[model samples]
Target: MTNEQVIRSFFETVRSGKDPDQAPHYMANEVLAHQINGENRVTVHRTPQNYADHVREMIDAFGTFQLTVEEVISQDPKVYVRWQQRGTHIGEYEGYAPTGKEIIELASAVYRLEECKIVEYWIQIDRLGILEQLKRNQM
Candidate 1:
């Protein structure tokens, strides 16, 4: 699979509302890296394990989240995508209860592919804005 194909498949899976499995097969293992925070605009370099944990956390929190690709730019080993993600806060997340609120957020991811697999991924999203929309912030 080419890098473009890998990135496409990843987005397709998420959009299909399937459980966030098949991640290991979608990403490279050796130097598989990721960055996932509000300020994560670039890959901070990490292992596949980090992304794995992230996926699990998201799944556990949202139960059923959807990531819609607004636009995608693909190259041999690099794919950049802009997306919108929305889900209901139906489970515990970061010590917050399921507010039963649906929140939508803008996000992006940059993937570095190696040998037809994603070796690195960097993600950014407006998390604070999301929290505010959910009305879970006491401050």
Candidate 2:
């Protein structure tokens, strides 16, 4: 599969709440995951199983969210993707109690692939926007 195809499949299978167990097929044994929110950046090392668990956590909070790939651009070893995710807040997330509110999140990531497996990624998501939605009724 091409780099773009790998990223698309990763989103479809692992992130779209379809089947997160397929993470091993797309990610390397040790992957570097960078989370960027404005000026704050943090890096975490992940195995395929760990990545799968992360997706499971997301499912726990969002409850079978729908992810739509908005754009994809690829060069050689790098692929960039923009996606929009929509779901209901059915479980606790980031200290926020579930409010049964519909949440829409926009995220983008640039993934670096080795062979056909994802080796590293830098991602940004609209987490603050989701927090704002969660804070609406509390305030």
Candidate 3:
């Protein structure tokens, strides 16, 4: 499959909550993830196992989640995706107890592919907006 198709399938897998098991098939063994939000930034050297663990955590925190892909663009080894995610907070997340609130958030991701496997990625999400909604529901 093309890089664009690979990314699209990856998102679909994530939307189906099957990311933990399928990540290895789409991502390279030595994947790099850069996540930036305003003044905070984190980088992770991700392997299939570690990526699966992350996906499991997300699934636990956000129950019944759905990711809507707004746009997808690819040029050779690079792919970009604009997406919106909606889910219900059914479990603890980032130390916040379950608020049972539905959240809608936007995010963008850029992926670099090598030999049809995603090798590197950068992701930015509406963290502040999600926190606000969770806080509001708690009050």
TM-score each candidate. 0.77, 0.95, 0.94
| Tens digits of lDDT, candidate 3, 53-95 | 8777777888868878999999989999999888889899877
Best-performing candidate as measured by TM-score: 2
Query: Per-residue lDDT for 4-72 in model 1, tens only?
Result: 777888778633346355666666665534557645434455445665666667767776777788988
Q: Write model 2 residue lDDT over 2-80, tens digit each, in one string.
A: 9999899898888787998999999999999999977788999999999889888888888889899999999989999
Off by over 4 Å in 2: 137-139
The per-residue C-alpha lDDT of model 1 at residue 52 equals 60
Q: Which pairs of residues collide in candidate 3?
A: none
Q: lDDT for every model?
A: 0.69, 0.90, 0.86
Name the candidate, 1 or 2, with the larger lDDT value: 2
Q: After superposition, how far is residue 86 of candidate 1 from its true place, in Å?
A: 1.2
Residue clash pairs of candidate 1? none
- Give the 10-residue window scoring lowest on summed lDDT in candidate 1: 38-47
Candidate achieving higher TM-score, 1 or 2:
2
Clashing pairs in 2: none
- List candidate 1 stretches off by more than 4 Å: 14-19, 31-50, 136-139
- The residue-level lDDT of candidate 2 at 107 comes to 94
